[model samples]
Target: NTLDYDYTNEEYDLIYNPLKMQGKKEVEVEVWDYNKVGKNDIIGVVNIDILPSKNKETQIELFIQPKNDKGEVQSNLNTDQKLGKISFSMIYIPEDDYLKRLRDAELKKRKTEQELIRQKELEEQRRLDEIKRIADEQRRLEEEKRRQQEALNAQYIKGYVQFKNISVSNLKKMDFIGKSDPFVLFKAGESSQQTTVAKNVLDYQYLNEEYEVLYDPSVMQGKHEIEVEVYDQDSVTKNDIIGAVSVDILPSLNQERQFDLFLQPQKDKKDDSSKSETSSTNSDKKLGKVSFSMNYISEQDWIKNFKQEQLRKQKIKDEIIKQKELEEQKIKDEIQRRLDEQKRIEEEKRKQKEALDAQYIKGVVQFKNISVSNLKKMDLIGKNDPFVLFKAGELTKQTTTAKNTLNYDYLNESYELLYDPAVMQGKHEIEVEVYDQDSLTKNDLIGAVNVDV
Candidate 1:
């Protein structure tokens, strides 16, 4: 094939075959002027010779020789014939060396391609890691913001609700011999407060009993509903659930709210009565009714009003003292009056302290020498790593983990928990839970037991 070009200067690298020559060989070069007419015109030709004993590389200059149409060199005519000069280099290579060089070049090409692929993979991995880091940071920021808002809401007290004048009437009788001894359980969210039991009566009035409900996001999440349950007190068996009712607390936030809720019977009562011999006729009717009043106390306004009232009382007391001084009363009488006033103040303080002290009964409970036997095997390589957790009400404590033993004893593992009887009611049992510790995941529970305190 012929290569055509339309430029004044050009360069090209060419490879030539030795054609299995042993001693010497001859090579010819030709140039031609392409034409669109009939026959093509020859520009010039050069003849070269190659020998086996020549150098590896050689440079040559083009000296055009004129030739006839039959391809014979014309030595008779000697006019300096030249179009453009060209120079080239020629290298001689043997068969074995040529094959080795070809293989090395191929190997280098593959290594370069593999290196580029590795760099691209590393770049992609870095980009993915950066994306994951950004996502994690954003999640952390959102969690922090939520926690801060929750803290702010908990610190601010919106208002208070005074639940007073509480009473329940016409409760269902749980006992065969006498009327039921009933009590009211008031629960808001996870926290609960109850009134003292009323002994053996169909209707009961809580004269001096009152519950103060504070509005805070941490406790009740801003005016959530309150759940009321009535139960009959029993000596032996579990207490019987009489009825339940839910009271809305939103109205108490605006003004003094009054509630007259009719209690509904327990859900499983009808099913139990169906199995009983003497089923009452009023089983499907309303259980009873509860009447209560709630007075909303705005924290800011109540504080301001209380200070004003205190100032007014102080002024009145001052006026009275001035009038007593102007009357020219006896000195002994004045001393006696002052003594009586001091006694009144002391009595008031005593009553207030007693009222506060009645809220909780603090008690200390100690656990010691805890052990567990026959724990389930959780690990394939060794015995279970077991620990004991003691939970009483809202308090919890745990024993140290004993490693690689079936009959493990946590000797001298003692703990203490403070319990409030009023808040916990009759749920005074300590829950003992056994667990197997794991390094890669959550601890597995083995067994549990409850001990009554």
Candidate 2:
């Protein structure tokens, strides 16, 4: 007998009692099956015992095809089916562990990124802080240097010096210590000339300590060559003849006088004869008629010219003195004007101070709860009036009232009374009134006990 089974759609098939059996015992049956299976066919071999506790019941399924044209079973099968049972077991996995690990990794990555970001920010901040610190320090140093420079500049001195004297001759050598240069005036005959005698005399005080020869009146009056010297600070004779001066002196007045008398003629012939005899006796004298007359006229002209020059000099002196007096008077007037202006300013300041003091005194009175209205009624607002005291609780509940109200509109010139519930304890209400600059009452309000103590 032959049994066939098919296992195709998740089902098992059994084939038993094959026609060709091979076994030693009668009860033990061997089945012959193909080694290979075809599509959806099974191939295998098994042995079984029918009786006496069958030799472990065996089953075989074959997957075969017709080997010949007669349709015989083939030994080789070509199928995806087998005769053995296939068993599968499933394992359960928890997502928490993997999720936790992944979360941890993600958290670590985030932490690292955050740390890197924090470090970068810190580095950037440090760099900025360093730059700012350096800049601030540089600025501080520059400011210090500038301040020091300014101090040094302030330390240097800048000023001017002026000196005046009647004449350069009146000035001593040492007087040129702080002077720049000196101007000299020479009055030769009737003509006066001004000249700058020396420049930077203090710089050349060595070799040329003595006055220049050109400045000497004796040399200027005589016909001779005069040399001037310039020296250095070491007193060494640097240039002994830096400048030269030539001068020619005129005839003396005495000689001119003697020649003038010799030119006069006698008034009578008898007198002339006597004079002629005397003149003959004095013939050896160095006076000639022509020379004597010329001398006489030159002497007369010199006298007239001298007097005119003197008068001119006097006029010039008077003019200089007048100008000096006018300049001095102007300086005095300016000083007096400044003094008067100062005094006026001082008086104004004093008045302002007195006014401020009066205001301060008035402000003090407001703190003492003194009746400002009574003072105002007495017209004693700015009179430095004495303080008035009120009975402890005499007017406590008088309940003053106000009309209109106080406002910030007139803050500049308005006066308003303020109430303190702390001081007006147990009182029903407090009222404030506003008054105008003319002391006329403007606003008042009704009192109430709504204020907190």
- The candidate maximizing TM-score is 1
Best by lDDT: 1
Residue 346's lDDT within candidate 1 is 88
Residue lDDT tens for model 2, 40-110? 33333222233432323244333323333443333344353344322222122234644686699899999
lDDT of 1 at 242: 89
TM-scores of all candidate predictions against the true structure: 0.31, 0.18
In angstroms, what RMSD does candidate 2 have relative to the true structure?
A: 58.4
| Candidate 1 lDDT | 0.72
Alpha-carbon RMSD of each model: 44.5, 58.4
Instruction: State the lDDT of candidate 1 residue by residue for 351-432, as single tens digits.
Output: 8756755544669779997888887898888988899998878889989988887788787678998777765655657888
